[model samples]
Target: MGWLAAGDQYEVALIEGRVAARATSGRAAGRQLKSLPKALRDHPEVDRLRRFAEWLDRHAAACVAQTDLWMVSSLPVPTGLLARVWPDEAWQSALRDLAVVGDDPDEVGFLRDATEAGELRVVNLDGETVRLSPATVTLPHPVLLPDLDDLREFAAELGVVQKVEQIHRATWRKPADLADNATTVTEFSGGTYDSRFALAARATSLGYRVTGGYATCRVRDTGAIVEASVWIGEPYWDDEVTTGGLSWQDLDGRTLPLREVGPVAWSEGMRMAAALHAGRRVEEGKDT
Candidate 1:
């Protein structure tokens, strides 16, 4: 503490007509600064540096949230939006290396860049870079991605986890009314992505709420709103996931009667189960 304390007042002295910092309590024991330049506090470069630091602080989280919203809602993100944010490092990192589809949904490729001219630069499966001039581009759901195996391999090699829920989001179908007494058994135990993380990731990406090992999605079934949930077993990554049963429930977590479960809930529950089962099979190379 004594060493950290300032012992005496110091003053800038004019020694031989040159400014020098001298100790008032002792002798002139100060050394010269590297350079006697103007203070940098008010310089233009200082303002630029401050702004850059602020941008860096907010960019990464902002990019993650925006990209998630874009994917979950399947929102058609304008090329202009991508172009405007492309210059930021965080935005570029989030958008790059992920598969993106433009106007032609059939043509999917890894996003390489957002060009200044509002075009997208992408690398296709054949390993060729192509420029696309589409009005809008989207990061498609994983199930919709062409050449998904290759993309997954590439992503694994890069050690990148998609922050958005493109693969795991639930696919939707037209709603239909259930019979007065209808019941169905949906199995989600086999699939391409049978891992707990894989199934939950997809459901969560599709705007489903994952909690307590249940990946829940709310849907409107024949004019009535119901919640559907799938048992994802556990939280860890396993070689195989022996998921629990799937069910349709009400807001209070009470199981709905078969007759009360509508067609949409049935379809969505079956879709989740089938997708998970498919992922499990995919993991086991049954579908390869």
Candidate 2:
């Protein structure tokens, strides 16, 4: 009780800061609204955005606390829309750890090919947690170290990797009923890409004006058209697929083998998005 009383002034100051968080919320909502095209305006998605804006307004200060917990805590996000919709540090970090340990859900699903997976058995070193695993599984450098920078990177890597994993698995889990309007297939490209999605991500990272579209490329002049699909949503627009397996003769000729890329994890997001996308009623507070 005495300790609580001692920190009463600091608590008041924190609550005062929360009351003044309107400016922060306004700026974020402004940035989000400006990015939408005129077509998305008045759409149901827009309503979701507006509600998101309002939630930001209500939780701006709470978000600050959540952010602190996310960054400072060694906890994992596990699964929650609160993180995807309004990502906290913990959610981001979990994904980062996921990517670092090679369980990257986005870039590629777990190469479930192996029964024995190498794990980074983290051990506490002094006051921090350090990953304990063979350095051979990774470079003998920062990954095993206990450092804030490493954790920050780990979280970023996970979010991106999960997106990668999301593509191969998206449609099968649940997808664009409009999947009929758009066809997905593996196509060919001539350009040398270390990683198509990674390459595209770097370009967008530097603030380049870019849009996802099919480009004809060649592997030694084979002249294959590579069609890469991208999705635009909150946070970042992402590349969904890049295929160099088909012929341009197909997209133009309108007859081709098709396969959609996505992750098995999206079954939850899909069931929700599909219900919404398909204009089916979803009861509030319902959990799948």
Candidate 3:
């Protein structure tokens, strides 16, 4: 609640119940404290900041998880449900920039704004702004949506870009009978990363598309195309966290049987998973 001198060179204070610190004097004076030792960073305010940060990280993960559920299940989410959570920054951040389809399903566009009073705004594929009051909305993954390339062009014309990578997110098609014929290409555990962004970047460099917290790519073999995806953890948080299992799917969004998968598909999927697995870090570090 008050400014205190932890040492002659540093001044720290409780700012709104969170620890804030600055150099007393020098090139770093008045700047935030960083790279301090564990004992020194354990101040009450600092601890509060840390806790809030963790909460934010989890919130982002939850958003991706929820969106993924919607896409995977092909379920229609009630507009009222989106309205209720729209006011929350975490939810809004997650849902923003996604392509939403109303009752017609043909009328698809990018979600631009949602008022606290429940008014929804979107820029349609025709590059015109439209208002809507549909009972529900569905966020379809690009692979599931037709004219995706045209939609991307429309978004570009409208100067709208996705913040959450929905349009370009990696998606795998589900096989017709996933449960009976499903197989995992490879499963790697103990993979570590400083943050999700680094993992995403690594995947992107390898020509994999990131979406819904997973790195994905499509493989064509023997006149059949299958999707391969590997789950990377949430984007925030500093410490190392293990990556999720890498799997393959058919066109219908169902998991494929490993034995049914072509050698090329299997090899590529494992290549992606293994490359990502190798990039994991052993300790906490910077996001960039």
Candidate 4:
């Protein structure tokens, strides 16, 4: 699953086939996030950066219910946090293993179960730390147009779905600042500025997911929080196209404004589609 915000509006892409999640330039709404002040953004500004990271980290876990928080780069979160989330013995071990693993129903179920255990403490599986609250989706900037689709028919064919019971179109427009580039965009990848994007994928599988709204699961890889966007059995194609700025969203489960809500809907919509499939599992068993 890949999401890009357009001004206040955001688009979530549920991909399948050769195409993975894609984020084009101007896809997400370029909203100013509650970022750490410049003084604290780096190591030298430890006093300032530490305070901001702490505050942002807290919000990420608290603001979004049942989700995981992540960023485009792992720089924002310090290693001190890694030691705090896991046992010192296991901490280093787990910290070495933070990479996006596509939606493993087992992990989802595990998260569902873990949160029930308590406030859902953070975990370190390697160099990466984990959160079970709101998981963030980051981009260099907003995607004016990213890969999207309306796959009611395709999802139904998968047998995991009963039907595309509903398809809703919600759009919102907001003011945004655009330039040749942004300082916030500290990095760029092979992904293009056009409709094509290099989106987050499962470290272990090709399948992508765009659902499971309450929480996000991210694995840290190469000092970046690698969160998988797509889940198993999602559809990704449609001739229909639209353009807007990239959008921003909290990995948290808080309600985003309609504009910022598009990607979230994509996440919700995919789960609903999968739910359509899960229900079938029940009926089949009842018939037996």
Best by TM-score: 3
lDDT of each: 0.63, 0.29, 0.71, 0.27
TM-score of each: 0.46, 0.21, 0.53, 0.20
lDDT of candidate 3 over 184-285, digit per residue (tens): 644564587767777888899866888877888776654577888888876564555567787888899988766677655665677678778878774547
Residues 47-162, candidate 2: write the lDDT tens digits.
54456556655565454444333322212332223224323433333333222222231121211111123334321212233433232221111212234354445445444343
Q: Rank the candidates by TM-score, best first.
A: 3, 1, 2, 4
Kindly list the per-residue Cα lDDT of model 4 for residues 23-107, writing each as its tens digit. 2335333332333234323323233334555655555434222112232122233333433443432223222223222222122
Question: Which run of 10 residues does model 1 get worst, by summed lDDT?
Answer: 1-10
State model 1's lDDT.
Answer: 0.63
Cα lDDT for residue 86, candidate 1: 91
Once all C-alphas are superposed, what RMSD does model 1 give against the true structure? Answer: 13.6
The residue ranges of model 2 lying beyond 4 angstroms of the native Cα positions read: 1-12, 20-258, 264-272, 277-288
Scored by Cα lDDT, where does model 3 land? 0.71
The local lDDT score (0 to 100) that residue 140 gets in candidate 1 is 63
